[model samples]
Target: FEALHAAVAGLPVSGSRVLPGLVLRRDFAAYCPASGELAAVVVTESLHPALSAPGVEFVVGSEGQYQASLRWCTRRTEAVMKRLQSSNVKLLLSSVKQQEVVIYYAKLYGVSVVECLSSEEIALICEITGVSPCTPFGDNGEITETAVATFCQPLLLGSKRYVHVGFTSVCAFQPHCLILCGPVDGVNEQHAAALQGAFTMLQQLFKTVDQ
Candidate 1:
């Protein structure tokens, strides 16, 4: 599915294999669609874009240390969210659900949160944005300084909702999306394999011709 999706996008953008578009396949999970600017793609270790601070460990009689850890995290998380907000980052995309404390601060800072993104989707976003996947910030191995998305929204297709966006920094051509849907998993898998193979062939052919 990814190979085909990228190939299709390559066609419109002068034919380089780096995908000029992004695709979101439905996983049959019930999720609401949303719209926001994907201005930055940050690779995070934790839900928040901040690093864990050095704090005292909690012992049987020392719950204060645990409380301090929570407080430290919340303060750092809020600071990070504020930076994102000031930078006009309206969307927060995470691979998993974050702690409510993270959510509350993001909301307070006026950033929309979208969780449950798969690794592929996140990688695709990074590629489209030309963001380095291994970008590091401070002592933490997280990236917080990449931006590219121009427009973003969620679209309802079939029985699922998919996020859609138009890129501002895409390849020379316009972005594209190829959504493949099937009633059953087997059917979709077969179709995805076939489609991917076909596009792979075309990609090889294009590369040969370009060379």
Candidate 2:
């Protein structure tokens, strides 16, 4: 459990931490297998088709330009997925939403996807996993680095849904998550505050022990 410094982004990621172990509450995983596990995960921004942008400014009589651009974007996504497949990467994570075409190609390549992540979450992930937040995105985009995980699956905590993941890192701390179950937001917030105070006390206790 190294790097649990002051900036230890508690992140309520129901999110990312740079420590060896991380607590991630993923939005959702697509095309996840029955085992709910992925060998490696790559986090990136968006996977939208570049050709489909509204700002492309079509010609006065341009008939099939839009359709052609869409096709091109889709094809590029396919190529990117192919590269991932060849690299044995089984999971893709996106900080932003993914387009349908990107999802389709991912699934076709036998890769799973977790999308709609916040920037902080993405930063934590990159920090902990030692993976850069770069992937095949733009016309010149072409990085597909990955972080290995022991397990990746959906977790049901009360009525809310979360994703539980086991990351492999150099740190000795195995990250753990604590979920406060309360009917209302106010109660949960109170619980969070109490927990934070408790953790602070524990940290002090640990320092005393170290001394």
Candidate 3:
């Protein structure tokens, strides 16, 4: 990861821009079953500060104070809920993983989440989509709409735990290809050397095409 970050930092940009003009997020996975239905949810407004804040606590000396605080919290939650319900957004807030949350929101909001991505992956996606990646959260992070194309196929290697997941945003021109190999065990030296050779050849091919 450090090497990847350094490589991205070393990329040349114009006008004193040191960092590459790309958005790269790690440990963010948004995937849904291909056979499942997709729904659209547009968030027309930003969330309230009270609801968006990190933590909530109330110091109350009496029942009335406690009740008031509880009421306030309820009202805030209901406000957000009403907005989503009216907008036809599906809300999943119970014991859900981060990846699940991203998937749900993406499905509701008509967007796609690029997961387990490296810097190179990010650059490729941006080149394909012709749009900068949006942050999942923040002032500029709110996305209006995004389209994604997902491709999934089982390796059928007799291991259910190993699956290849990948996607790309819709674009006008042809996009680059990136395939990430999963971890394997009990590989001989010959196979390792062959794999390395294949990887190097692919890299050279990409460089040639780019040039």
Candidate 4:
């Protein structure tokens, strides 16, 4: 709590800024049956904080490759997939071992499947980015395609655990949102300034608080 408070208070008044970004992937989608709409109750308790940041954005679409011939594409699906593959989509699709087949297929279409991070890594990403990290409190293994049904457990009539972090809720974590800091082209000056400022503020805050 003290650290969080300090980081915010010590934010740089002025300096070059570096935009920090985070990509969160979960295998929950693969846990559902191959066909039809399946439901799962992934606990968002951890992700609530990070997804709540200002400027944080969410894009939902196909996560894998686009092998379907252009002729087969419906305008709606095509439009949605385009958004999912946009340069702004930093967080990678998260899935478990069972979904490797689907993931492989997704890769064939140009999707970049990032291996699921462990709980600790997840925590680190959230802490460093000032986003709230959500961890599954239940014990489970990397899911496979066949066993994906296990992830679709129904929520009780009055329960809310099955809910996903709403789209609007996830996009709010902007200022602290992890900016994509990778070898990409066309990054603007404002992004660089944001990143630099975030780091500089953090450093100065640490020094002052240590005393």
Candidate 4 stretches greater than 4 Å from native: 1-83, 90-95, 131-211
On TM-score, the leading prediction is: 2
Per residue, candidate 4 scores C-alpha lDDT tens digits across 1-211 of 1111101112233422322232232333222222322211112232112212468664435433333322233332333223333422212323233134434333433433334445654343343334442232224321111101111222211211121211111235432223222222234334455656887899899999998
| lDDT, residue 42, candidate 2 | 54
Kindly give the number of clashing pairs for every candidate: 0, 2, 1, 45
Q: What local lDDT does model 4 show for residue 4?
A: 13
Q: Is candidate 2 or candidate 3 better by TM-score?
A: 2
Compared with the true structure, what per-residue lDDT tens digits does model 3 show for residues 23-106?
A: 233322333345433222222222322323456664569998877776675554345434443443332211112334335544
What TM-score quantifies how close candidate 2 is to the native fold?
0.74
Q: Mind giving the per-residue lDDT tens digits that candidate 1 earns over 12-117?
A: 2222233335545423122223355456444444455433345854353467876776677677777766766666666665666667777787667666655666
Ranking of predictions according to lDDT: 2, 1, 3, 4
Q: Put down candidate 2 lDDT per residue, 94-116, tens digits, no spaces.
A: 77778888788887888878887
Model 1 residue 144 distance off true place after TM-score fit, in angstroms = 6.3
- Pairs that collide, model 3: 41-108
Task: List TM-scores for all candidates, in order.
Answer: 0.69, 0.74, 0.36, 0.24
Q: Hey, what RMSD does candidate 3 come out at?
A: 12.0
> In terms of TM-score, how similar is model 4 to the real structure?
0.24
| Alpha-carbon shift of residue 44 in model 2 (angstroms) | 3.4
* lDDT (CA) per prediction: 0.56, 0.63, 0.37, 0.31
